[model samples]
Target: MPITTEKEQLVAELSDKLTRTKGAVLTTYSGLSVAQDTKLRRKLREAEVEYRVVKNTLTRIAAAKANITGLDKHLEGTTAIAISYTDPVAPAKVLSEFVKELKGKNLEIKAGIVEGKVIDANGVKSLASLPSREVLLAQLLAGMQSPIVGLVNVLHGTTRNLVCALEAIRKQKESA
Candidate 1:
């Protein structure tokens, strides 16, 4: 059936948002009950991600205009999109965890877009496996500081040893 005027407007708005998003994940959701669907939507909302089941044709048009090509191929089956505007990895992590919990839900990640680049299924999985922004920043800080800390400790040890040797020599000289 042709989409209604309101639906067209809604799709247009969603497409605009998708165009401006930093990352988006496309997934094929089959064998999910209505209750499961509601749960998924709730989780997505909690993560501040937008999830929608758009018509494949409209999706293709929006994707092409936004320079996201090759997404049409994965548009087959019962497709839904999760768009993330602020945090690129949020949608991926959420969807990956949801799929894991569902187990036999038959939810397959099709593809994704990150920083205007199209990525396949494996790419999405890898993206999902990435740590959050705060965690990554903390790890980076630790990595950057470790060498400096080691250098400081080494310098302190050398200085302490030299001081101890000087003290011993002074004591021996005084005794002699």
Candidate 2:
């Protein structure tokens, strides 16, 4: 079958998005009101995630073009993709929080891809449970500094004790 220019454009655009995204969450947004959808979009936008309803077939083509596999099964249903280029956890975290806020009313998470690896819904939730990248990095830095800080304190204490002993000897000699 000859491909239409419009479809080719769509495929190209989606392929580019898929290729560039660090993470993407597939969701079923059926039965959501316009207000709810807008709110969701706004939240996702603030998190620097792109949320858009996607045609399943076109997305499948795009996924193939982007060399992403294992996305076909989750592509069914009322599909919208939340993609983030900067933070792999942003989409999952934002979507999970939004669904929790809605009390799981209209939006249902299907699956997700992180760093090019396809993960299940539970995996997506686990990813969302993690702290943000900055927080994790901070924690790691603190962890790395802990031993050094302890060592410095130990050295300082030893030097202080030696100085105190020397002062006591000097005082004894003067008294004698």
Which is the leading candidate under lDDT? 2
Model 2 stretches with alpha carbons more than 4 Å out: none
- Residue-by-residue lDDT tens digits, candidate 2, 1-176: 56799999999999999999999999999999999999999999999999999999999999999989999999888999999999999999999999999999999999999888889999999999999999999999999999999999999999999999999999999999
TM-score of each: 0.84, 0.95
Segments of candidate 1 deviating more than 4 angstroms: 1-12
Error of 1 at 140 (Å): 1.5
For each candidate in the order shown, give its overall lDDT on alpha carbons.
0.86, 0.95
Best by TM-score: 2
- Candidate 1 lDDT for residue 53: 84
For all the candidates, what are their Cα RMSDs to the real structure?
Answer: 2.7, 1.2
Model 1 pairs in collision:
none
lDDT of 1 by residue, 136-159 (tens): 999999999999999999999999
